[model samples]
Target: MSVSKLAQERLGDYILKYCLLFEINIFYFTFHTTELRSKHSTKYFLLCCFQTCFHALCRKFPPSVNYRKRFLTELIRRQETVDHAPLDELYDALADVVGAEEKSECYKSYLLPCGDTVSLLENVALISEGTTGLVTWEAALYLAEWALDHQQVFTGRTILELGSGVGFTGITICRSCSPKKFIFSDCHTTVLEKLRDNVQLNGLTEKMSPAVSVEELDWMTVTKEQIKEMEVNTVIAADVVYHPDIVESLVKLLSKILSGSAEGAPKILICSTIRNSETYSGFKQQLEAAGISHHVITGPVRKVFPYNRDSFIEMITLYK
Candidate 1:
């Protein structure tokens, strides 16, 4: 595909994934044609791209404020490089995405390198509905990047994700990693609802991709029987160590799940953002107390997603 086709594909994927009604109709215009000797077609195509992007910013489920703001700002900055004069729509779009009020519900879409995309409808507020689990964390992005880099870790393995927030990591893995099964587990009802929405949004439901399921898991009260029944051989958690109590609960639950695995003790991978030193240390202390051995992992040379490369994201490989 040509460069413009690739761009349209990516943008179309994002629009469909997020259900960006305001931005969905822009790609109908011809953007990848090379034989356009007439300036009319070229101008029309460019207008479609920029105008739809502006309309997207004015929509309810537009991209994140920071992303839209930066995109608009950069467009205004680089408009002079193009063959056409800048349109007033560019400044209006900048103001729309920048000055729009935050909505309670919005979408976040991630375009994968393999032309697949993972999108989510999430709460704009961090602590929405009395739970922080509604928002995707940095560690989840980091873990998804790591998983995409190391596909062998999940290939043909039944994977279970603990504390899957909005199903970003799970959906990404389902698309990129060749896993036998993927079970996404979380506790919050609101988060679970949105998680299932995201999973279905990515078309990973049983109807489309038979190997995915969303389950409600209470880490503190889960029984060994449930873990055994899952028949999972790999476990993963991302950004689950925010609270000390939660860390204790997670370690205890992980110890039980790992010890009771019928598939020869599943491989456990925990990815966390080291936001607070003491909280992370408490997590380590809990892991040690549970008699589970874990070590930091550091072998991925490249990342698969666009995220903060300099963030303090770390992965620990745990074993029984």
Candidate 2:
């Protein structure tokens, strides 16, 4: 049976989202007979899904073994509902995962709209090594979507990212937006180490155009000289406004970077998840007190990465 255009689109989306390890509930696999006529069509769809996910598991930078096991288990559980036995390949993949030792690190790959993939080696835990920078945050995904939509802002421009955890947004911009230079900055030792590995994993080393570099930048201790030396035309950050204390230092850092620029102040774009209302409000107030003007900018037109859609994330633009 031929699948409708809508069904084909939905199947493609499901397959890509699964490969990226997006949160797939059991309900997603509950296929209706009316929608897909004939057992053959249903089986074809299931095979396509499993093959894409299996390829992701065997990729050079694969997801964690635990994650792969969970995915395979879900697919196997759905096989009974379809009145069909699980594919032998699916069982084999699960066996491999079960036999392998689990690691603290894993890889998450995002397929960009430009047909390029941004893969990063990230910590499996939400917070690791006394810092949350070891993994990509929701706000980083939000900001990356926005940047891809506004490619002109970064194209041919030198960009500096503050608190660039795991280098997701920066790498995405460098690959898709065609930035002249991309610098990823963070203070945590473990975060920086993993960030550099991710950059190389994505093949964004210095040898490539839009020269990519990782720097250790502590917002509290960063100086005007340091910001000036970077000579960036644009400054961006994501998920760096979690605490009230950091608000003061971030505002000061933005002020220094803007003032020290020779070819006029570099544009500042900051994206943050509104986990705490008071903390977010304090960020804006600090920007005002420091003579920096900020306005809430529009979000991305579409999402290219998987993230918590329910979370409230805001993107703001700062200027002198």
Candidate 3:
């Protein structure tokens, strides 16, 4: 059910008061936000109680069926407010990119596809929003785009994306050129819903239809079936280099997925920002030492997100 603005405002404000009063750490988020440090505050104090409560409520409640209107409103508002973008705007932007010239359409602000059924197809969509777990499209696009530049090399190739958050990078290429079979991998089942929704949001069913195949390829828990199912010829990862501790393990997972190529040697494209630069470096060195070959197209954009001038995304295209 839809929460009215009046009720939401009241509940949100009330929740904010109670939570912030209950936990004073929220003010720190507002105060510390200007430091150029990107820290997400899930637990805000009383003043931000609604934010937390809202998320918790949504999680408790299944995906809201009545959110179409709300999301439509949000999508429009987001496109207009990109200079001062909100989470919704990023999602709309990610959903709006179209391929094949004028052959694309959007339902409201989201792209509309030919059908609801999904199969392995490589299409590209804008990846925006996602400031949480997955790599931000703002940081991941450069790498995906680079792969697009080489699209002729891998057209109709089987592709896979691990930890595909909101799926901007993967969807974008799929729309640009039709790939034979495609797989989208993510660790979180919740975000995968959005990822599937996003694939449909872009008019890509005829181009690269949705495939039921979302695998939980946690870097630490990757399995052979996951790799076999993925069977991707080209793999791309973006903004995943921030977690230094798992760099080696993450690369290992990539190794497993990419190891199946018998013909032309598999290729992998990775773009990441260095929250854990030293560890990321270690991962890179290890990948190189393995006889696996790769080309580093770009590296972390040091400025800030979206607005970072001279901020280049880190990219690595690996082959074995």
Candidate 4:
């Protein structure tokens, strides 16, 4: 049984589970391969495939991988179960699995540590925190990759990421972007803690990596004190504009973060892929009406051969 074969067998189910919330292509990337015992051919093949998926979505002169999304449009046919549970436990358990499974480090040793609930990587109902977190329908990794490709926006700047799922994008910047600092903010303290553990699992900390912080930031009710407490100068969010109802409140939070800054000015960079025309149109209008116009930059996302249906990010820059 080759590792690739083993991985492929599970990839379909994983894709289906992820597709329940996002486009299935979002979960089809290569899992971690940093310290695989597999041969170079297998390892390199996995890496190339991942790059292809990323590049295809980022619009980087298309690669050679031709993948599609509708293959799973009818695949993830499960209704999202909204069982009530503490979010911290969910984030901790899920983050442990994701961080350990991450190619960055700690795989094989961390297999969804807390065996209490549904996989945080898949289950949505278990995520508990201060204010409710609306489902943001997009891959957080692609957003991180897009932001990394544009290091100039984050280079030497204090950056903050809200609703950082598995802390992939913020962690990506800690590893790839030349930011002075990176803060991974989430509503659930459990997610924040797992994000912290992930940073460590990857051997990243103040001692070994760039400056990073994780905090509880319920966007809807964030106070002036909370905004002032953060030292961030730029904010980045991925696929966070899905729900039209929360756009105004979320933008207001970003506005508050930007409003209190003394240094030149703060920018809120939101990345999304057009999931639905109605949501995209309304979110854009909401941002503009609040005096925060949006800037769209097509990122060079993938290196693989991309199909028209590859997962990608929509880079949005906001300013008053």
Candidate 5:
């Protein structure tokens, strides 16, 4: 392959991975000054990179205003160095990007496979209000995509989501799937507050069929009454199996719910991004010990959400 083609491919791959994940520092490193100076087709390469980056940011809903501003600022600087007259369209696009209100919290929109968009407001910080549930994790996106692919399983069923971080998966399911009722449960105060806002932000406030509800569920201290009251025919959770104690508490809660759930036998779907091998293995071991069986679901070929392909997300369904 030609050197110019190789460089263009490399830059495209880098931007798609880092920029989509909001990794601003990595984006700069990928497009470092030394590499740009060395390339002979500097103008073409820079323009391609700028156009590609701009399109990617826009495609990924709830575009990160801060990241877009930083990316455009650097692109403008580089364009000025290469050509005395930068593109007027670039400046206009930058102004529109600047119009995105800077705030501690922001919305992210995801275009579902069913032609529906899911938008959520997330904390700028990864960890906020003493919990790491303020933002949409890759596993949540993974599960949401999986649910979209198999809507038949959720149609007309009462679905309950545990650890509904910012309500991404739940809201997506609520909008895309025909669930009879949707319940979002979280233990943290701030997480629950934001989850409700996200549910409303999607204009899902009408108390029609598939009525949406939020509940404060402490897995460690949950009561039997709460489990019985859920009346959920299906339970789903994403990115909730990070810590060992959490795994045990979550397993206990699931066992209690499965043992006494009035919905006969509820389907349980858990999607987890395996950051730690031990944590994932521990979760499986606990499920085996509890006599619950799980099956891994295959992922779809088409992309529904903009997330890293190498995130190693896994989706599993549990049966009693």
Candidate 6:
């Protein structure tokens, strides 16, 4: 069978597993080619697809060395089944990755439905720099997917994202939802630094019209005056309700932000992975005690990014 046919069959697997490349419209290749140019036209055409995909993979948003090595190895293995001679570009790409120095940091790119990519520089380890915020979490992916569907909530509104981590949810909203301004906040110095890098990596700098800014926001000590200064219409946070102390502080912070808003209480959205039922319930209880009403948002139908789907992630909208 031809490479295009083979790729068509495995496209879904590639997207779900690796998420290294966007969906390539195979019809583009077939429709554009009127006639075979050479005896090796099929091989050449397949190589063109690889080159186009890998150009973005290598230059724009390269995955880790390990992922790249595995991808190239699989490609070469598939090629061997069809032809005896090896593709030089594939071999060279593999060699480069094999020889490249491995590092703690790597880039991950998520393909959006609008054909734009939200690329982030993430730490390979889940916990790095004495914090979990260096890497994007599953809850952030779930929140981002939800945001894409509810763009109207964000459009023309200023948003404040608490515990922004690596800025995945904020950047995705800035790119797609048309938010008027986005403020990414985290308490940790390391997390704030990486969050700034990710915001810049996605090209949502402060200079943009829908202004983007990163700030240090410690929920435990943040005052009502500080919340009032932000002038945000919406507040969001993801994966921050895991710890009891954090949940307490987060509830207090949300109370202050809601009560202090100049116009009115801003809309609040908190997405959390239900890692511990006790902790999740504690969060809800605190919200109720603070006179904040919240309800679980209906989960988005479209899953845009690859994440741990088995994790029970819930989105909650809050009002004061």
Which candidate number has the best TM-score? 2
Q: Rank the candidates by TM-score, best first.
A: 2, 6, 1, 5, 4, 3
Q: lDDT for every model?
A: 0.73, 0.81, 0.49, 0.53, 0.76, 0.78
lDDT of 3 by residue, 29-144 (tens): 23222211122221122123234323343223212222323333443343343334345433432344322132111211111132121122212223323334332345554654
Instruction: Give the alpha carbon lDDT tens digit for every residue of 4-77 in model 2.
Output: 66766666656665443543443454544455445655555455555455554436667777767776787666
TM-score of each: 0.78, 0.90, 0.52, 0.57, 0.77, 0.85
- Tens digits of per-residue lDDT, candidate 4, 12-69, equal 3343223222223443543344323344334333333343223233232211111222
Task: Give the worst 10-residue stretch by lDDT in candidate 3.
Answer: 103-112
- Whole-model lDDT for model 4 versus the true structure? 0.53
TM-score-better candidate, 2 vs 3: 2
Model 1 lDDT per residue over 1-320, tens place: 23355555554444333323222222232223442334343343344445446444335335656556655555454443443556576667667667777568777666677876676887778897889999888888888888889989898888999999898898988999889899999999988999988888788876554389999999989999889999998999998988876777888898898788765888899898888999999888878888888989983566555555678888999985
- Which candidate, 3 or 4, has the higher lDDT? 4
User: Which scores higher on lDDT, 1 or 2?
Assistant: 2
Top lDDT model: 2
Give the residue spans of candidate 5 off by over 4 A. 1-62, 74-84, 92-102
Which stretch of 10 consecutive residues in model 1 shows the poorest summed lDDT? 21-30
Give per-residue CA lDDT, model 6, range 1-320, as digits (tens): 34465543354334333434432222222312322243444464355436533554547777677766766676566555446567777787788789888789888777688867777888888897778899888899899999998899999999999999988889889888999999999999988888888888787878886899999988888899989988989999999988887788888898998899889999999999999999999999999999999988998889777676888999999986
lDDT at 65, model 3: 24
Provide C-alpha RMSD values for all models, in order. Answer: 6.3, 2.6, 15.6, 13.9, 6.4, 5.3
